[model samples]
Target: MNTFSRRRFLQAAGAAGALALGAAACGGDSGSGSGTGGASALTWWDHQLQLQPAKKRIFEKFAKAPGGMPVDYTFNNPEKLGQALQLAKQSNQLPDVHSNAGLQVPAPQLINEGWMAPLELSSEAVANLKDVLLDGIHIFDGKVYSFPIFDYHVYTNVTWFNTKVAEQAGLDPSAPPTTYDTFRAAARAVQSKGGGAAPWTWNIGMTERTADQLNYLAQAAGFEGNTGMLFKNGEFAYHDDAYVDSLDFLLSLKKDKLMMAGSESWVDTDARGRWSAGAACYYFDGPWCPGVVLSAAPQFAESLGVAPILTPSGGAVRTYHGPQSGDYWLTPKSKHAEAANKLLSDYFTTPDYSVEVANTMSQPPRDLDAVEKSTAHAEYKKLIGWFRDTVFLAPTPVVKNVAITKVQVETKPVEPNLGTIIQGAFTGDVPDVKAALKKLSDDSSAERERAIKAAQAKGAEVSLDDYAFPDWKPGADYTLDQYK
Candidate 1:
């Protein structure tokens, strides 16, 4: 985003510089609680940083609202939260209300390890969220441990443009560039009419995010699932032409000198500042883009506009997600079970809470209907339409057979995974991108089979078929009727 930034910012970003991440987590005064020296106190921990202002506002109201308790609220970034929760698990210091967002462990393992306690919300409360709930995803072992307060039908590759940058560069922010060629043209146009900022920028320093955009772009290029699982043959297929083409397309942008100089080393947070300052013309990010802009750079928020993702072939981009599931979990150690349940279920589903969450515009509320009537930004409302059109619900292995979670737990990560491969290509480490992808695909397949066998030996009834969905078609919804 800047010489002071692009060079100096991200070296200490992400995992390498995360040693004191626990201290980074701000433990707010639990303004309201059971008042027994943290005993039976309803504590809540979240990983969302962008909406802290809104969260605080909600909690402040909640403390005074019906059924609200003194929530000792805390915040952690996802990476640190993963580490914090792991340690908490060992020490039995798990927060009564925490999220499984970055744990990487499957829900089954979390449940079996006593990571959760059932909310047992009233049927009325459960029915209020029926629109986004999935049988197996929101339900585990016939009990609801967690349920989403937001929707997950979002992708990371939406064509986000600074409206000011676009119009000045002779491009229509309303009609965003829809194809690779046009996207490049828009970048060149913006660069030619530069106001000191570059035409385009990305958080390429964030390997995982960069990798996600690649997979998502691959899906736009006609791949099936978000990851390399074809589901057609029930196997990993990361080396397909879709992946190569997508990676090639991204590399082409860098090669063409259309990116902000030194921007490759920046993370999304870095790019956000640039984008908010109107130093960037285009970004590929998700629903939270607008909210973050509004919060961090309000002056530039009005200039931010979103369009559907720019696909390789100008086709509908389908970002596949499984049924909405619980993000927040109640730890087994919670003594404020009744109060915690209200915070977890009753409050989350309440109309007032949903409206506040929807308006916050980080993750959309589970109630899409509330979004229409809420005070959310127009860009956010537009995002909802895109989600309905482009986000398809895919079948999950855990949904079909819960034991597959055990297999997932057994499966080890294949190194130089897609994100790293893409990052290597960007950094000129990987000479042949296609070959690297092929090796990754093969490695993933072998590892998956090995894990399946190991889990089977342990009496987990998972098989290759558990992952196969022959009925799945690219860009189409994997309906429940076809779950067999």
Candidate 2:
């Protein structure tokens, strides 16, 4: 199946019934109630509505809020949230409070289009937020428009290994490779075991996943750090030497048959299934793997080992980290903006609520301290520690120029989907690494130029200089301060 279609299918499966039933049956209105002396009808939509117990607890808590608003809570998967929102927009009945569905559309775009309302945190809420959330995650253009609820602590580029596979292959599962050359050696050892196991498996058929894998390899090579998209000195740097080297390294693995057979056709679930089944010794995924794998193959729990992606000798062990998940936001058309914000602030910033979110989601909460003191799960705490010690934030540059922002956010001057080009190289369809990279670079540069012109036509003040950050270095923190 096409990876895109497969993802769509999975998302649609969760939402089809609710969508068909329309807003009425999907908790459209929880009826009117006045316990705390406020208009008691506010709609809240979240992706986790399918979890009945959690849903009930959340509703119960909201019902007890100071204002005591009756929340018409609706559930839809993140993948379908955007679509649902669009439908709601058409009907002029958008939810007062909702998650960004993983920011499917960039926050800036949503704000600029007047779809999302800017947030106003009280002094107390601000202090609470500062004490818990990481700095610079929710702010945009000097205003907060979103709030962090749940975050994946472990960077997304982690490599998970089956200890049994490593032991069978005569490798030390205790000391997983931390360098590329050593990693290759380990791969060779795993392959030499000859029990139908492969060194690595990934959702190679998916453009986004394949691109992320390439980016991880690039991170190991010490070119770009964790920000998966290529942005160097304020411009797309996808066609650079480091990127080519990364592709060449991946190509080497493909040529050597280190990747599981038929992996190029595998979707995310297929790859995950193979990894859980021990068909592959190595898999790359986020922090959620332990819970997922343990649930699927409970007996194999003791055999699982997780580690950061190996860096090249002398390279920084950096990978993309931070809140790459859904976030809560207030809608522009919300009549209960103050009430919605109050509920959200209380839910996200309050320690008990934050801890509950962390425990239930098996992810870290916005409150890092809450995570430390959490009685949620031992495994989650360990994962949080690993994440804190190992990962660094890769900040996305905020260009002052609207044109530049349009290009970077809305228009997306460069497409990260190089899977076909990469697959061609693996299959000997495109053999020259330098030539392929040059073509990619040239195409991206041209698209960027086109975006600039388009932005200029719309009265944007943008230039190449707007995209330049010459002082920025690879493997170092890129923060909002850097933009200043």
Candidate 3:
């Protein structure tokens, strides 16, 4: 593996300019919810069914309860949920219950825009949530806006290697590579032993998924805190040395021939299928990857081995184990807020329902005890162990400049897609990484200033100060208190 210093990266980029100020804008939802088809039918929407079967039995039980409101669930892909919600909010036809996609829009923004309803959990329900979920994620400002069911102790940075392939390549599955150099060596080894197989495969074609994987690698390559558009002292640190080094590392993978050919055309599902079919030696993903493999090739399930994402020697082994609120929330337009709340309360508060969701989804439940007692497949236990061993509960803070949120809400810009930029570098479409990053930095800063002004005009408390994290040291533990 190749290495570059932060000093060198910054020296190559030259100096950044000052930020420009602008104004904020506000909007309102004009539609109202239509009641359920039946007297107590409650409409629900989520993306979980894309991967697993809906809990029809559980829903049936809830519907059978005395004065129970039957749930009319509509399962859509999580990727499409944000867009669907935007359309629903426009016509005032939001569902009674919905899942929030954190990446598309921050949960706090939804609450600020009055798209989400405030949840009022019972004392016991609150305690259960407090024990299982990360408190910092659910509560925005000072109030709770969402309740998360799945807790990703480990994010999408893990390397899932084929143990059989490793053994065939004279590599030890027990001691997988934990550094870029060793990982590259192992990849080369697998390549040498290949029978029409590639050493590694990834979803390089999908910009969002590509960005996700690259961000994790960026963290490993000394891009200390945030993955994309680093901010510090109220300035966008887009051309930072660490960021440039990350892009350089990604380019090195392509130059070294470690990445599989045709990766640039592989979406996540295609890559996952190829990995499961043993067409590649390595797949980078989260714990949920095994479920995909098991579904596609059950016999190869036992051949898989999991490892924490590799970092440079002597670098901090920090994982992106922050609380992602893939939570269910009551929409503001819902006519049956009380019924929706009761349904969610019953679903999560019940031990069986919680365990069922976790087991079926092959994820770690908020209720730790429920996980311990779950009758899930043994592979799930291994995944849970991976989470416990590698996940960093707290690390350096990645302060979100409120401007980014405001920009996302108002206009979805194509420039922030770092994946496309990285892909361009690999394809030789972007010859100068520094120049691209500099341009991105300037554009993002301008957008941030505009958002700040717009938000201020609308009486929103957003400023450069809100995005500043002055005392944050790289690799230091950042508890919830630091955020406050």
Highest TM-score against the true fold, candidate: 1
TM-score of decoy 2: 0.72
Q: What tens-digit string does per-residue lDDT give for candidate 3 at 172-252?
A: 998988777788888899889866678898776656555666666666666644545442454665577767876675567
Reference-based lDDT, each prediction: 0.69, 0.58, 0.60
Query: Per TM-score, what order, best first?
Result: 1, 3, 2
Tens-digit per-residue lDDT, 191-274, candidate 2 = 999366899887665444456567666766666533334545655566666678777766677778888888776655677778
* Tens digit per residue, CA lDDT, model 1, 296-388: 566766787887777876755677766566767778878777777766555566777667766767666666678888788888898888887
Cα deviation of 315 in candidate 1 (Å)?
Answer: 3.5
**Weakest 10 consecutive residues, lDDT, candidate 3?**
17-26
Clash counts per candidate, in order, are 2, 1, 7
Question: How do all the candidates rank in terms of lDDT, highest first?
Answer: 1, 3, 2
Query: So what's the TM-score on candidate 3?
Result: 0.77
**Highest lDDT among the candidates is held by which one?**
1
Q: Assess every candidate by TM-score.
A: 0.86, 0.72, 0.77
Off by over 4 Å in 1: 1-41, 65-67
